[model samples]
Target: MMGRTRMIGGLTAIMMILAMCAGCGIGGDGAHDAVQKLMDAVVAGDVSGVKNLYTLSVEPKMPTILTGAKLKQPIQNVTVGESEKVSDSERTVPVSYSLNGKKTAGSFKVKQDADKNWVIQNPPVFGQVSFDPDLTIGGKPSTKDNKFALPIGVYEVNMVSDVLEGSWTVPVKASSGFDYQGITANKNRKKIKLTDKIKTYNGSMSSLIDSFNLLPMCRKLKELYLNGDDFAFISGKSISSACKYQTTDIQIKVTDYTPDGDRDGYYPIKFDATVKMIAPVFTDSGENDDVWTCQSVQGGRQCAKFVEQSFELKDWDGLVSQSNGNVYYRLADPDQNVGELADVIYAGHGVD
Candidate 1:
């Protein structure tokens, strides 16, 4: 019985020693290994591997923003120093590495969770700014800071909140054309304001009538009067200055609006209008012997005859309305989906 007791005591002592060694391997050495693995994952641009070493609570939420620009730099060397225990469950590991031909220093923390598994409490430190087409703006390479104020023009902006993982594109255009009205964006995202240029009828009776040129027509009549063979020469029986053609009661209506893709702020519209004008004509009296002449009486003078004519003008393309009130035509930008406004303010907006 005494011999059996001694053997049991010896076995218990050996088991305790083995347990101490196992604890040290998992708690101290394991933490140091976790820190090294984190740095290796960053250098390799392995976001999944990096997350695997993080605490379960933080792993899913970890952002790959640091990998945005750093992944392009190759990791030349990495040296990890001894870990210092903060408590029974946590440790800090010191690190130094060469990246992209430059030396850098940083630190991280590792901890043993309730299950006694080693995980990175803090990941390797790195800062990055990732952009589309490899961080360039206005055909120039971008600086470390991500913000940019580009000149007003058309641009295809590449966007990536975390460059290492994936990216999307943003098409931005700002100019005097009728298409792009405004734009909104942040560090890695952007939005373009869409609008449509609509054609409207804003002309008045007076404005439409003023567009007619009657001077040329009047000159043609003067030529007819000078031909004495056609007209009789009589005292006070000639074309008088008082004889004039006049337009009255002009009615206009706009039925529909259509967009033309080729022009800016100019579109086609359907229009209908009634035009009434006085026609000054020399009466052909059929008295072959008597030449054409004006008639005059004491109280009133009636020279040439006066005739009233009414006509309708309708067209699909000939008529147009102004989108910008300052002009006489309508215009639109095909690239932008914007609603119609009286005056399209297109020149000053930009993306930040």
Candidate 2:
């Protein structure tokens, strides 16, 4: 009776081991099938499924990485190659895939998580891409005129599709230096158009100061339409409505300029500004008055203590115009003082 019981106990233990192996997706044949599932998810652009194949740490970046990959190439087919176990909890997988009619081979390391499910242990793959005419982002130029590696996965590239003038398999990150990363223009590379509306951008201190008309060097503001239009230059009076601010006795002096050490094309500008202004307007003075009132009058002191801002301007001479030896520029956004002063002036608070 004792011998027979031992034999049965050994058989039960073997069965339990097999079940654990199957559950963790580590069985002899299961690893191949798991890798095949991941390849299918990628080819099908199954974002959810592909995400499930990787651990949680890599989940957040997967979307951007996938978007860049989709723009770089199209995966037509994927074949599972050699796969071997490195340990009880880890395995290596080799795969060959067809992209844009080209064959490429890649390797992956997959590991079993605490949940006993297999997950991809390698960072997603990305493809290299560049612009044809070359462009700059946030005043920082792309590598080697216009080349950089795209992030991995599925995504769209339409911000400047019209401007690029060619259809590509993958989307490209919009040139930097704008308020938004994906903000783009459909105009020619050299003849890009500035929006009629004043807006903030990222770039160099010189570009910001010039663009905002912070100093007197900018005079007789003009718009240079690079589209070969005969107008060439438009006066400040003509585009006054499009400008951010009009100043009277306004002075902007740069106190300091600091460049970012780690990243290119970024500079922080510190400035001290004084704007002459009439006192704020007030509708009522006391208790029942709805508007907040400090004092209502004309001709008062408005001094900015210390203000710091960052800028990203790539095209200075090209974006602005220099004629009669005076440089002219339009404001990208409303100056804080100018905007406040405008309100005061609008409310009948003018210099006495």
Candidate 3:
């Protein structure tokens, strides 16, 4: 969990570059002033101040949730870099909010409004969302003449199984990614038997099924709609996963709980290590407050140091995902070890 290497150097570099550009690029008093205001707004999560500096008309794009975080280490050596103008309307800035000695630094974006107020808009998540391999790369020109800011990863997917055995299995994670690792007690990969008990999925259920994963459902859904063969047995590639969507649920499961949440859906925010990350919005089970947050003592900074946050740009009532897979967290019920084992074993078979 600590040391994860990204083979995509160009992609990683681009992420760094974009993050730098995000911090706001300008070295001097002006840059410091911008950074100071932005940091204060960010630390306090003052929507108004952030909006004013970033020049946002409507509510600015804050993180999805501003809950608490567990400082696995001390958060110290806080550093703020100048903001640089990346585009006519945007600027990137570097910030390192550290604790103890461990650090997590990233660049953030500050965009200018028509009236010229620098507003922090783009969250790092936008970059996290760009995994499309068809994405253009390098200085090379793609068919659309659009150059991707980074190199795309080859989204390869496969399925392997004793076809003699009839069963729906999930792909297992191997060194080279997903691999078909036979069947186990965890998941009952039936051995060549046409049984009525089959776990079948269609395009309509999960809102998040892109054109890629839907290949498995082709038998029932008809031809493919998206591009690419992120799946195993499937052939041909499509353009995008716009064909699939995500699933919807009302159960609120919190991990990193925080109080500074948008008017959006539920989020997990933990206070200290106890309090059991709660989301008052969905469960209405935890304590309620206008603004919830995490608190921990470290390096004398009390708690309240902003760690992570989320805000829903859409999802008025909680229809968060048009498809499925946009789950809050991958958790298991304490009462069901067998269920977990089967699920884990099921992940071995090829998705398609």
Off by over 4 Å in 2: 1-28, 56-73, 100-102, 114-116, 126-156, 160-352
Off by over 4 Å in 1: 1-14, 21-28, 55-70, 130-352
lDDT per residue for candidate 1 within 21-139, as digits (tens), equals 54245353777777777767755656567657775333333222322222324355778777777787877777887644467676667778788877775453422223333333323
Q: Where does model 3 exceed 4 Å of error?
A: 1-32, 44-76, 99-101, 124-352
Candidates in descending TM-score order: 2, 1, 3
Which model is ahead, 2 or 3, in terms of lDDT?
Answer: 2
Best of the two (1, 3) by lDDT: 1
| Model 3 Cα lDDT, one tens digit per residue, 1-352 | 2244555666799888776554343433344466566556544534345445543233332222212311122224546787666766766777776433345577767665566555565332111111112221111212332211111111112112211122232211111112112222122212223111112212132222121122232221112211224342322221122122122222232223222222332222321111111111111122223232221112211111111222221111111111011222221222242232223222221122
lDDT score of residue 42 within candidate 2: 66
**TM per prediction:** 0.34, 0.36, 0.23
| CA-lDDT, candidates in order | 0.43, 0.39, 0.30
TM-score of model 1 relative to the true fold?
0.34
